[model samples]
Target: MQEIVGYPLDNFSLNLRDIVDLIYFEGPLLTLFENEYGDSYLYYWCDVDEQCNRWLVFRVTRKTLRFYVTQKLSLRELIVNPVDGFLYSIELDDELQCQRCCLIQPPNLPPKYIPAVDSYYDFSKLDPEETEAKGLLLEKIWDEKHELSDLLTKLFDKPPLEMIDEPSLA
Candidate 1:
């Protein structure tokens, strides 16, 4: 099997507890979902756009803390999360006690593991031909997102605020 190589960073430690603390302590906690067992999950996106894009997803359970980096590998694949997701699972000795935290890294990892570097795609920087192609792709993406939002709104019986141009106030 070929090794997955990424960009190296000085502060690219994969300590689960440390990562969780860092995310919480840094600020602006964006919780994606929570379970019935009082366990909350967070999906920290790398970019402003949120369309099944790359993200750092984690869940804090009563006895365990898990996290992973999800990236879109291929457009042809139908998988939700990336197959090469760098995952980590940490088990707490006691409830909410991180003193005896045990981290479990996935097996068969490359000897030289590197951190992923963030990339910014500026549409304005592209040439005319490239811009047209990229613009079309982006338009399709936004269209699909809009359609999904509308479907969900109808499914949940919620008001279609996004679809409406000017909401009526009465």
Candidate 2:
């Protein structure tokens, strides 16, 4: 027998920092989100999946990312969908230096169920530049550190992965 590994991560490499960043983004998501409620005294990292889609959420506030997704909603569907309904996005505006979040429903879901969810990123504790830099550095490292894109493609055909629901995953 050969050395046993937890999972076949041969396709890519993941560092501790990467894990931390992901936790900082997705902790709230895993747990039921109350948006404006709860205390965010802690920070963490979340491990996504084979495709490596990472996300970050806060306890004190709510922030969503439109472009930053690990594996999309398809993967989540395979596991579960406990959301109240539909989906939304949490995005940030660097030029203005602020944080905001919003949740809406999918086109297939009733438009009445979704709201106009939008806001800037929360950077009250750390400088926007500092926070942004750290996340960006991690992102850059992950993006170029390894051929993750190609690896994911190899694992799941481009079509199946692309068709996956995203909001459900986050």
Candidate 3:
């Protein structure tokens, strides 16, 4: 299956050490996160470069999963408007060190809705030195990943595969 553009990746070529060097989260925090949130469909990954400009986020709830990519700007607030109405943002300094990280949860939304993404480009094709590696077209990526086709089908309200399949004609 094709990969989703701007979606947090479960499987990637980069190792945890390489990935950790790029993002703010440490082993302890990551472990705590898994405990707080169930591990099924967990999304996590970052750009494999010195300046880790982005991160993929995902939270799987008892009911559903939410995903999006949060941006990291130089000396700027990490989160502007959260899609899930809640977030955990880590701001990095110019030296690629964490300045501050915070968990922003509004009273209006429940605890379940969380946030996650990867870039739109194919990592292998992009130049290591080039920063504007916003690779593939969004529409093409979306369609290729089956995101547009399977999103609605993935909603928890839909019946399970066993029920959907036709009974064999004996």
Candidate 4:
């Protein structure tokens, strides 16, 4: 358990949300630490470049920790969801020296919801517009069936879109 009180701060910059954003996207392994005062912090190492790597520490509330331990919310949820108050973050160098410290204000937007059908379909090759259209279509189909197995069975019964001839557009 690393303590934050005695940690050295140098070249500290405020509002490093970009670094936090990277951590949120990468989903690195999290280590929990507590200071003598019982403040909870999550620590994770991030490699920003070939030569640069840093440790990110986020101070989280007890309620947030409880939700995480109880499996009621995921770690990513803790990062993206707006906290009751500001979320404090510390960026430390390889030697555990603080390079930046900031309070992050999470956007007041809903967490992104990934539908189950995303796992079944490969949308990586599709353009943005096509991907959105296909995703919506798949979501609708998935909702109608309410089960992946049922959706698969139904899909197998129907002719593929490519197999069906398109009407001539004169």
- Which candidate number would show the highest TM-score if scored against the true structure? 4
Per-structure clash totals for the candidates: 0, 27, 5, 0
lDDT of 3 at 118: 24
lDDT of candidate 1 vs native? 0.31
**Candidate 1 accuracy as TM-score:** 0.25
Strongest candidate by lDDT: 4
C-alpha lDDT values of all predictions: 0.31, 0.28, 0.29, 0.43
Give one digit per residue, the lDDT tens place, for model 1 in 41-83: 4433332222222233344332221112112222112112223
Candidate 2 per-residue lDDT over residues 1-170, each given as its tens digit = 11111222222111112222322332232322221323221121122333332222222211122122323222233112323342322222333111322333333323222222332222222233454443442343344423445433433345234434478654
| Residue-level lDDT tens digits of model 4 in 1-170 | 12223234455443222211112223443455555655566554533433334444566676665455434566666665535343444555566456565454544212231112222222232233443443333442233333433433343555446445689999
TM-scores for every predicted model: 0.25, 0.20, 0.23, 0.39
Candidate 3: regions farther than 4 A off: 1-85, 106-134, 137-140, 144-170
Worst 10 residues of 3 by lDDT: 69-78
**Residue runs of model 2 more than 4 Å from their true location after superposition:** 1-20, 23-75, 78-82, 95-102, 107-170
Alpha-carbon deviation at 103 in model 3, angstroms: 0.4
Q: What is the lDDT for 11 in model 3?
A: 35
Please give the range of 10 consecutive residues that has the lowest summed lDDT in model 2.
11-20
Candidate 1 residue 98 Cα shift, in angstroms, is 2.2
Q: Give the clash total for candidate 4.
A: 0
